[model samples]
Target: MVVGGSLGGLAAAHELRAAGADVAVHERSAPRTPAHGAGIVVRPDIEALLHRLGVPVEAVAVELYESRRLDVDGRAVREEAPQWMTAWDVLHRVLREPLADVCHRLDGALRRVRVEGHEVTAEFSDGYTAHGNFLVGADGIGSATRRLLDPSFRPAYAGYVGWRGLEPESRLPGDLRELLSGRLTHFTSDGMQMLCSLVPGPGGELEKGARRVNWVWYVNVAERDLPALLPGRSARRSASFLPPGDVPPETAERVVREAEASLPPALAELVRLSDPFAQPVLDVPPWRMVADHAALIGDAAGTVRPHTSVAASKAFGDAAGLATALLGWTPAQPLPAVALEHWEVLRLDRLVTLAGTGRELAAASGLGVGAGRTFFTGD
Candidate 1:
């Protein structure tokens, strides 16, 4: 059984089912449509996992030929390898179709989990219960499974917030669109940074007027100051806890105004037009990745900072690794402890390093130009 029907849960369920296990996914959200972030960058490992899950790579937009340019104060500094960008909805739409045959119970929020002997019982908020040989919590950072197992674990704020949004390519002026089209561009200043890239829409074409631009801007803000930046009831919530549509009009305007004043012209315009969403960056310690019958994957396991763009790939990698371990499990047997340990070891170093690099970038955001080279080795 996999709790939480988001990307990690879905990927876990698909892998387990492919491994011939009787897998059932329990999602707390309604069954209508999947809720996801603005955009996701798919690295090679994620692409490989999709291939294994029978998802065609061609169906998703691939921005392989273009490069990611890093700039500071409007001056080009560095360039990194190409990356693919796709709307989360588009990717999920493709992933959902293949998993239609799998057993999924939506609106089934788990309230408690009881592990007795070799069997595990999951109690849901709706008063229903299900028993399975092994339970997986792909539930995300606030995982019920993790709470039941280890209440001491919590996400640690990484000292930064990422503001993101999407806009139509045509919405951008011609000169700005030309520079941003078919490429991932970054414009940075001291504590402020913005990244813009184009992704194919429903038509799967990049014709001058055909695609949409996805943008993410990272800024360092104090945790105490976030409340004043939110809208309505969310104003009382912490930066790490704010949900979608929580930014107040005044706060939103402040964010856009700051971008306009500090960022480069092309990048500033993207933020100006963006309906911004903010996420207080955080990372879970390595030890938090382990539990009784389940393991954390993606942001649920821990976030490696967006600087490296490795979160999605790590989640898909976890799914792939976990699937390999459960390939021959029987109903009477337990999941292999050795396999879980192996996965943890494989992921720990990369995550820790990325988190450290993210902190470094956050601390010295004003350094500009040469700063991008310190964390990212490419270009």
Candidate 2:
């Protein structure tokens, strides 16, 4: 059974099914629709995985043939490195379509997990329970599985927040549109890093006029000011991030003003015209990703800062590792403790290194203290 049916859980479900395991995905909420989830840098391993699932890659993705770095004055240099970009909404659809045969239980929020000698059971809030040999927690950063496993573990808010926007290509001024088209562009200043790229449009259309420019700006926010900066939907304080339309209008206006004052002219206009949202950068350190018959993947296991841009790829890596470890396992048998241990060791090692790298990058970028490299590397 997989808890949380977002991209991570869905990826886990797909890979495990490919490895010949019967899988079921339980989601705490209803199915998601596109909320301009923004762009994702496609990794080769992820592309290969999609190919293995027979999902046509190009139809849902846009190829970026170059990368550009712009200064505050809009002066820039370009490199011929090529990478594919896709909207988060597009990727989610493709990953979800292949899992039609798998059981998907919606609104099935997990309440507790029970483990016996060989069997594991998940109890949901609605008084429903499901038994299985193994369970995977691909839930996300606010993972109930992680909390249930280790109540002491809490996701630490990094000293900054990422403000993201998706501006329609047609809505952009001709000059600004031309400047951002067909490339990944980056800009950085003290305590801030910003980037933009062309991604498929709302309906996953990759045509010239149908595309959208996706941008993200990371700026330092004082810890004490977070409550007012991000007013949550409920009385509870905001957790990791806020979705589109959740950020207050005044905060969005303030971001636009900051962008105009600090960012390049074209980039500032992009922010001014687009609807911007914010997510507090967070680091979720994992004490242990594996516990008996259950394992945490994706943000559930650990979350590095977005400066690394490895969140999606990291989730896919976890899914790949878990599927490979359970290659011959079935629900009829007990969970393979030895194999799970091996997988956990490797995943843990990588996550620790990745988290350290994030801190180093954050420091170098002025989001934290100390000196380090600000290079972006893949998972």
Model 1: residues >4 Å from true position, as ranges?
Answer: 32-36, 68-80, 202-208, 232-245, 364-379
Question: For residues 1-379, could you state the per-residue lDDT of candidate 1 as single tens digits?
Answer: 9887777777787777878878888888777643344567877876877787666665677474556555545665445566677766666666667878877888878888877877779999888899987888777766676767777878766545677776677777898777876677776666666777777664555455777777777766654555555444444665354544666777777777777776776677777776776766676665556667666666666666667676667777778787787678775777678877877788776677766776566556642222322211112
State the C-alpha lDDT per candidate. 0.69, 0.81
Candidate 2 residue runs with Cα over 4 Å from true position: 33-36, 232-237, 331-334, 369-379
Error of 2 at 72 (Å): 1.2
Residue 314 alpha-carbon offset, candidate 2, angstroms = 1.3
lDDT (Cα, 0-100) at 323 in candidate 1: 79
Candidate 2 C-alpha lDDT tens digits along 1-379:
9997887788899889889888999988765633546577778657768888887678888898898999999999999978788988878878888888889888778899999866889999878899987889988888999989998878887767788987778888888888887788989888788899889987888898899888898877766767777874443356766777666677778788888988888888889998887777887885688888889999899887777777788888889999999999865676777888899899989889888898888777787422322211111
Which candidate ranks first by TM-score, i.e. highest?
Answer: 2
Clashing pairs in 1: 190-365, 190-366
Error at 120, model 2, angstroms: 1.7
Residue 104 shift from truth in candidate 2, angstroms: 1.1
Q: Residue 193 in candidate 1 has what lDDT? A: 68
Instruction: State in Å the error of residue 74, model 1.
Output: 3.4
Model 2 residue 279 lDDT?
Answer: 77
